[model samples]
Target chain A: MKADNAAIVRFENLTLGYNHHPAVHHLHGEVAPGTLLAIVGPNGAGKSTLLKGIAGELRPFQGTIHLHGVRKENIAYLTQQSTLDNTFPIVVQDFVAMGLWRHFGAFRRFDATAERRIAESLAAVGLTGLENRPIGQLSGGQLQRARFAHVMLQDSPLVLLDEPYSAIDANTVHDLAGLVRRWNTEGRTVISVLHDLEHVRSEYPETLLLAREVIARGPTEAVLTAENLKRARQLAEEQGELVGAPVCAADEDAEQAIHAHLGHKHG
Target chain B: MSLVDTLASVPVLSPFIEFAFMRRALAGCLALSLGATPIGVFLMLRRMSLAGDAISHAILPGAAIGYLLAGLSLPAMTIGGLVAGVAVALLAGGVARNSVIKEDASLATFYLISLSAGVLIISMRGSSVDLLHILFGSVLALDDTALLLLAAFASLSIVAIAAGLRLIVLECCDPAYLARISHLGAVAHYGFMALVVLNLIGGFHALGTLMAVGIMILPSAAARFWVQTIAPLILVAIALAFAGSVVGLLLSYYVDLPAGPAIVLTLGGLYLLSMIVGPLGPLVSRRRPRWHFTR
Candidate 1:
């Protein structure tokens, strides 16, 4: 596995599936260093699944996922939903401390240095003073911040987020984007699955439109053209993807039938 | 009245209270309570309450076999129970991880199988009503050696849990992050579950298997209504357990009730009161949302 330059992630001919039934077929992409790539597509277009495959939560049936020239344990990941048990009686500080668990030996205690690092991470995520508070008591936005704080504590060079903004308030969405911007500025590469097209257009310079395949990838302004979006919708429909049907419906219902010929042909 | 005056008011209580047997029982109860508090905290947070109940029932077969093998020596019986408890916990966890079955169903299946197997083992050994001790407990009959051993094990359980606090909490709440980073989730899950089984084993002599498991968990569940943070939750649970132990011991002495039942009953009362007065319970925290800081 030769290190792929400074690229944070390199996926070559990636095919992911369950029990040999293909979900994502022959997908390929590379995230260069310091690039924030927004992965966008209709739901079930394998956006989250692609992220999962890269996160190592789900193994790829084909192709290689290389991170920083090595296997992908070097990356940090955030899931679409918080997926945390809110009833757990843990403080925010304790939750953040989890990022350092991998650094300590089996019998080692958290040293003063590690504690200081944890404090720095919490502060970075704007959660400094609230570290001692229980995680169960966090509001929705606060919970998202805590999850981000956990990733920051990991201090990795590559960060993967699978829809970190769903159901979050507008201010939280802005803060999350700012956090991602800051991480990118610090030379960390970010690949996020985002549903919001507006956020993708404004915040991300690069975008990968997925529909169980690499529908489009490159600069967001160039690749997210009306023609490409129409093609993506048609491809998603052709695959019988659940999330794609609505977008196709919206296209047919909302738009002035610009792609009516192609939509009917695909349908 | 002062605590000393209360002690003095009952002259007959002096011997029982000061005697080695009673002292051992009290000490054993205290240690078991501490050891099991973390387990209860994890169980409730993970939404695995029924899992605890299942584990409690499943250890019966192991305890019975231990009794038969060592003729009821505390260590042998405890070791057997520990093995059984861990086996059940792992099997349940494995089934939940591998299959589509919900965790509750897996726990129930294991609970039923192991409990029936335990009964069968006892019957095969020609043991009759003696099995009641396993169900209700032998806390009052704790000898000095068993008490000391329990104390040691309890201390170890506490220290181990404290050292792994970050990983344990992470595994319980945000396991996705842990799994993403490394093998921390696997290690933490198995390690903490092992401790749970060990705690139940250590507690068998103090409360009998059934009540032992109940006392380990129920107090922590009650304490949940009062606190928002994990540290505070554990502290509140320890305090509740200590209070329950003292009151149960005293009540058993004065009322001529069995100590195990009395302690469980006292804990049950505390839970009911907390449900009425503490937050998130039926009666309290209903009118207002308590504002807790989030990191």
Candidate 2:
């Protein structure tokens, strides 16, 4: 119920699930503006689900996900690279131009200024000459860079990226990571789902480690402790194939304990 | 004879100019090609080409019911087909949304049931000839009413697609992105389905429910072998569909063939040829490296 002006996202008693089975259960947290946060967890820990909830793609099964002061239009989401169909018949420039959808909407012409911005974005990603090329023709590294250009065009204050580095080369990863850092420097709130602990340690200042629940949420160094990491893995194993509606009394007790713990820490 | 007279006297153009039925068939086919082929391109792009076939089958029972009620009245049959096609589309979508069964599988189930139901209904009341007409269509027998219906549907499809081009493309290529920005993702999806039903109804009148999807999907599939972008793919598909209609009509006139099958067969031939010769086609572009035995 408390709305903080500094927070870009606030998750209150949030439980996100499919078919009533919670993938992200009883999450209580607030993401302050301009914080570059990394959400790291084991597979099926609801990292992507959390991002989808924030992006409004999935509604919370139990609670509210508030976007503080920003409208949904001000949030830019880059889905996991694997979900995109590369063989789709879209050119790189046109694909990148889709990021400007919020600005011009469906029918407006992509006038000269828009074209220039698209060119600038492509140049920033070092994909200048390849604008006219079909996206399917690009190499994995090049495709990742092209997607970065798209994110640049989006230019939203709240940016959420899911598995942006998966299946990408180290060089592309480094380059794209630089773009993430640049966006952070420009005071954009960025939350990324990353697997590389080393990268998260080096680049991201804040981290949230999840295993179907928040195990730790704080500074990168403190949250990624060996004990916390081990606990997250152990929790994931215990949860096992039992992802569903929160009908179990044991889950409710665990959720109440977590909420109490979070309340005590914040208070 | 003069050169103009000689050219005009050629059997290909002469049949279309001489026979009113040929001209009516030509107009009907052209209208369907322009409207439905573009929709087919989107379906192929979305990997829902089979859904187009399934939806066409779903229309059969509706048309049968319409036949039973109005005895071949164009309006009743068209409305019935539209209702059936849209209902199946919405139902399949709903099932996919709610259950573990995916959209394609759900559509397959519904369309099979519909096809069987349509066959049963037709057998119960109508003669074998009437059933054949419904299944295979009567393109050469297209009257003024059917042509008017086709023309109207074609116009509506063109306008609707043109107006919603960006939304439709975004919905097909990157639905998550569309959903993030606006609720137009759902709008585009449902709107596109409505267009599919409308175009399929038009196509059913000309090519029959069984073969209608052929005119829609084959040209788009063949065009995919050639074009790498959506705009050109749509253009190529429409052009291919139009050519198929004209060539198939001519063949039917000359060889005494069934018009619907002839048109679809022509498109199928084009698809096969494109598979071999077009750029990025299997024959032209070697996806696998050649193996050699070395000493």
Candidate 3:
């Protein structure tokens, strides 16, 4: 993949991993500004890891990821809902207000403007009257909506979502997808890891398909081909043995498998 | 006697008003409740309730080493316990981060080692009565210095908790989000750990290492049954802990029970009662839904 000067994100031979074993290896790509890109891949395809790298939660093992025209602090990341503790004794209002931390900071008081922004975010996500309700009492869909409300309040130029539609209702998926579209229309770059390919094809214009390595990237219709998906599944299945297996021979096998997959793609 | 006179002359209020030791004990207990119970609420919320118990035991060896070095000096023992407690906490966190051993397992391993080491050290040079004092505490025998230490801990705890309230809440509720946005996640985590260590040191003085965690965890667990929001949960836990201290001190005076154990037992009883009758209790709020079929 070639880097574009007009692109917002340029991944230059980036490799990210834990314990010296790579999850994403030698990936090169550029994401244009204000583009709605869906990262579609099988399990363990480094989809979440890629998002984590961009979010600065995980540093790249090799190479660099350049963010053009935006600071790292300006990127808003919506983690998987499972990563949050629902049983915590936090009300929805306080939880959503956390998005404003970048503005008010850890000790700053929430003034009238902050309160109005919080209310607007909540109302945008259709959670206007549920401010005082404890998050523990919210249903899964409602919790996801609340999280969307938090991300909305962030008001960043870059938004990253990891499987935002998983386990959520269709209505919520529709509402959140609309919000994603709105964010893009407002000139914010939106990248999401999605499982619903039909929704991706219908809603997203750009797609990046991965199975430990980039399978294809470009227009959704061109990248998410049937053959490319089959190859991704094959690569994922081959790499499955490395997941949580003892870090001796399986690591070598994973590297070999990724190399072979990439070789076959290029050859 | 008139009703007012009878109420004023109740045995519960007499020991507290008449005896200086009883008054000191009351003050110590209240101070501990103010400082430690809030830390316990955070522990329970983070599912680190057992970690609190582990850290409490981890303080024993440090305090024992202090006793060995300074011969029962409060400052020496406090400094020793704080160092040991924070060291174990940092060690466990480091091991969990660097290795495959999870946080709970690492904590359990360290606490066990610390507890065994402490017991051995104490048994080597100290008498049985000294051992009893270390294990069960001397709450009713609190001196002016001990009272001062407890008051200082209480003040520091309140200020620290107030200063880091938002960051702590954000860290507990959604750590990943906090990590993505700012460095406050680590700040909240380590800052809260320091408070936990400070409170544990105070609790050890008031209730002994064994029962210290009880004062921290029981009221928080009990409060979870009653409240749905963080602020109210903390407030109710503090109230419950305070009530337990007063009632337990009175019970100890009237019935001739050990003060530390009596206080823990009182808190335990409150937890049990809350489990039955509190808002989210099984009896109060049925978890299962009643079914109906329609034609």
> Which candidate leads in lDDT?
2
lDDT per prediction?
A: 0.78, 0.88, 0.87
DockQ of each candidate, alpha-carbon based? 0.45, 0.64, 0.67
lDDT (tens digit, per residue) of candidate 3 on A47-96 = 99999899887888666899987778768888775568877888899989
**Per-residue error at B193 for model 2, in Å?**
1.2
Please provide, for model 2 over B1-295, each residue's C-alpha lDDT reduced to its tens digit, 9 standing for 90 to 100: 8775676698888887678999999999999999999999998888888888888999999999998898877888888888899999888879988999988789889989999999898888899988888888889999998999899989999999999999999888888778777877888999998999889888888898899899889999999889899899999999999998999999999999999999999999999998998886887768534334354
| Stretch of 10 with least lDDT, candidate 3 chain A | A244-253
Better of 1 and 2 by lDDT: 2
RMSD of each: 8.2, 5.3, 5.9
Over all chains combined, what TM-score does candidate 1 have? 0.87
Residue lDDT tens for model 1, B8-121: 567556645566677777788888878887677777777777777788777889888988887767777777888888888888989988999988788889988988888788
Q: Provide all candidates' interface root-mean-square deviations.
A: 2.6, 1.3, 1.1
Residue B271, candidate 1: C-alpha displacement in angstroms: 0.7
lDDT tens per residue, model 2, A1-267: 123357889998788888757888888999998889999999999999999899887877677898876788668888885456789999999999998888878889889999999999998888989988999989988988888888889888889999999988898899889999999888889999999999999999999999888999999999999999999898877777546433546566467767886899999
Which parts of model 1 are misplaced by more than 4 Å?
A: A1-6, A69-71, A100-129, A242-267, B1-7, B10-18, B126-129, B289-295
Docking class of 2: medium
Write candidate 3's Cα lDDT for B42-79 as tens digits. 98988889888888898999999998888778888898
